[model samples]
Target: MDEDTPRLLADTNPLPETIDARLAQQLTFLIEIDRLKTVLRQSPLAAADRRENDAEHSWHLGLMVAILAEYADENVDIGHTIELVLIHDLVEIYAGDTPLYDAGKGLDQREREAAAAGTLFGLLPADQAARFRALWDEFEARQTPEARFAKAVDRLQPLLLNWMARGGTWRTPGVTADDIRARKAVIGDASAALWAAGQELIDEGERRGWSRPGSASIT
Candidate 1:
């Protein structure tokens, strides 16, 4: 090394291959996000217009958080919850969205979704893939408050659609209020206020002849 020259040092220990792998994984997420824009599915209510696909669902829920964060029972990181909601339904791309009431035809939806998650999220680079998989798992478990809030928003969307559609698509293939309530009661734990509003919608539906009254019963 020359005395008056600037010394050149090397980054001898560069970031490992995992760094590139993780970047690739994140790219896959971006690609999958774009791809989901094309796959449309019906809501639980079976609306004729065809419910928005997974990407739209995610975007809508993100907006929901922005609009409804004040309604959350406890302080929540809206950004994290929004991330959970956005990714939560991606498994449906491979497994298909199984309506809660029509679980009959599928080969065990839970098992199928688990498999789908493995493959879909696995497309990411290893580290990024693992991070997203954890997020997806957290959302599915509904254990943490953020996950619970995300799940509540998930259930709330369909109910609002059903109510607005004037008893529209929910009448499909023998779906009843019992089925809807059973599928959505987890929301009660997430946000009791939201769940109460849902119950009121159910009650109002029954009173207005929009849905079957007292159908939330187990009988």
Candidate 2:
């Protein structure tokens, strides 16, 4: 290791010399994730004036999986689903948060996130790096039931926040309810019940002028 490595470790939390390579790698990965706390998201907190961060969003998704698993359309492995949720946004630490309505940013999101995933997940040991990357890939593919439900929860989260905040993101110029519905209709794929609830919020948002009108459908 470089001379700077030891000082870097000491500057943060110092670990015992007995720590193995795997443990050191794991710890490094954990420390690296602290940067996620600084990455801001578009969804604003209902009670706070500032926007939420990537780490907060991931934690909220994990909690949402725990509390709302029963609402999933198919029976899902809660732990796996939670893992997917927690791992999904780690890429944002490097790639930055991409707003749903920003078509320009959305265009290169997949490429940007893929590169970020490699950089972030590579901090772990080989086995763990593969495992975490697999989880991230599964969440991105949205093929498995756990991944689908995790994605549904992911999409539902900001919708709930926007509704609770009374047009949080919807209030943005040119961001209409129809545009949101068109984008968010995927929520129904994993949980019809949750989508039903989300649908109500979107409709009410439009009626209340929380979001402007557009041409589209939800589910």
Candidate 3:
């Protein structure tokens, strides 16, 4: 189910009889975010034949942070960075996945996602809601070392998927190798080491015809 907007629906099961009000609010938010699993992305699963969902993408980022922390330019708190990646895209439950190569949609991407953050995070108890919203804001700001690394991992993961899937979104018409670099190069913000490797991967993708060639009008 490719849901564009998150449905505001109640779960089939009733809340537990002994649950406190705060717990119920928290549980409601948890249940609501289950929709994230249904929101499909553009990147194909390297092992599977279908596109992975938002929840899967976040989980992959957590693991990637663990595996690749050593390569970050700064000595980051790995756990905090993992939290940023995991929390970063929960707003997509409402906003939906914006494809990296989709330039037109990217124009309003921040506004769409900020509204989503407001609606989704507001589901939690007031205090928790504020905290989660702050975390999401932090991820978006990319000011701290952890946020920068998290963003890098976020971009780097999709690049790996596209390469593994033999030009996944790179195969999209009009999305040239330069287009790939222009977007994915944000990886350099956190890790010059990773970006160096990623640039080679992009170049190879173009050389092998995995990515489209020529400056086609993407906008």
Candidate 2 is scored at a TM of: 0.91
- Report, for every candidate in turn, its global Cα lDDT versus the true structure: 0.72, 0.87, 0.89
Report how far residue 107 has shifted in candidate 2, in Å: 0.8
Question: Per TM-score, what order, best first?
Answer: 3, 2, 1
- Please give each candidate's TM-score: 0.79, 0.91, 0.93
Best model number under TM-score = 3
Total residue pair clashes for candidate 2 = 0
Estimate, for each residue in 1-219, the C-alpha lDDT of model 2 and write its tens digit. 223222233337666778897888788788878888998999999779989999899999999999999999899999999999999898887788999888778889999899888877887889999999999999999999999999999999999899889999887777778889888888998999999999999999889989988864322
Error of 2 at 80 (Å): 0.3
Predicted candidate 1, C-alpha RMSD: 11.6
Cα shift from native, residue 176, model 1 (Å): 2.5
Candidate 3 off by > 4 Å? 1-11, 215-219
Over the stretch 1-219, how does candidate 3's per-residue lDDT look in tens digits? 126544555457767869998998888888888888998999999999999999999999999999999999999999999988888899988888899878889999999999899888898999989989998999999999999999999999989999999899898877788888888878999999999999999999999999877764554
Give the per-residue Cα lDDT of candidate 2 at 117: 89
- Give the clashing pairs for model 1: 25-124, 25-125, 45-169
| Candidate 3 C-alpha RMSD relative to the actual structure | 2.9
